[model samples]
Target: MSDHPMALIYGGTPHRFPMLLVDSVEELSEGLGRALKQVSANEVLLERFGDAPPTLPSCLLVDALGQVAILLLRERDGGAASVWYLGGIEAMTFHTAIPAGSVLRMEARVLKRWRTTARIEVKAWIGAVPVADGFMVLSQRGSGSNE
Candidate 1:
């Protein structure tokens, strides 16, 4: 909540629908932020594999973290003309399964930043339990079109 408009934030993002993992941004400032993702049984991924347990995919946790990282970067740069891409992930660790109906809280911080790339550390939790943590690299490239 850095006083930036939600409409602008959403418009800056490239993801849509099932790919937009971030449900809401809770906190945003400088190079740090927190975001939320509510896991529900109706999610598209849950229905992709018939009879699959209603567990939130761990990969989605990473995706959510990446999305939040982009939000932070975008806010800091005032929606710069760039496209954020998931360039790398490292030291990813999962501690528990995110069951349906759980509200996941993710925290991310920019550990390092360069002209075209940012290294971030992210952690996820459900209530009081830690679920996942990792480091990710986001590459910022010139936008091909107005973002």
Candidate 2:
């Protein structure tokens, strides 16, 4: 287990290495959070491109944002044991290709929350350049679920 505070918070989620996109949590508060992901040349997804300049796929970029949103949810719920799912995405836009050597800064804010579901607005950037923005719906299954 890692000693980093963010790693401890991440322990509440089901994500693991490789699939765990958020590298660090820089800030967190009610309904808001910010995180970072260091894009590296050795990223497993970049392997498919071989000799081409390494660029993170758009899907992964969205996944990164989702992970950040999850962090906010986990913090808000006080590390409750619950399973979260990405229920939907809305109006997402990709502004540019993210190169491997760059760091991705992700921000998520809870737009609304009701019962077991939440609508979060997420955005990603490489330096000052906007890379992606969208809204994601996340649904939580309480620990009481039989599954």
| Top candidate when judged by TM-score against the true structure | 2
- Tens digits of lDDT, candidate 2, 1-147: 466865665675678887888888888789999988899988888535667788998998888898888888977887777777899999999999998799999999999998889999999989999999989999998776312
Off by over 4 Å in 1: 1-8, 47-53, 143-147
- Candidate 2 has its poorest 10 consecutive residues by lDDT at 1-10
lDDT per residue for candidate 1 within 1-147, as digits (tens), equals 344545645755788786888888788888898988889877867524476568887777888889889888877777776778999999999999888889999998999998778999999999999999999999887665333
lDDT score at residue 80, model 1, on the 0-100 scale: 71
Instruction: Give the clashing pairs for model 1.
Output: 1-28
RMSD of every candidate to native, in Å, equals 3.4, 2.6
TM of each candidate vs. truth: 0.87, 0.90
List, in order, the clash count of every candidate structure: 1, 0
**Candidate 2 lDDT (Cα, 0 to 1):** 0.85
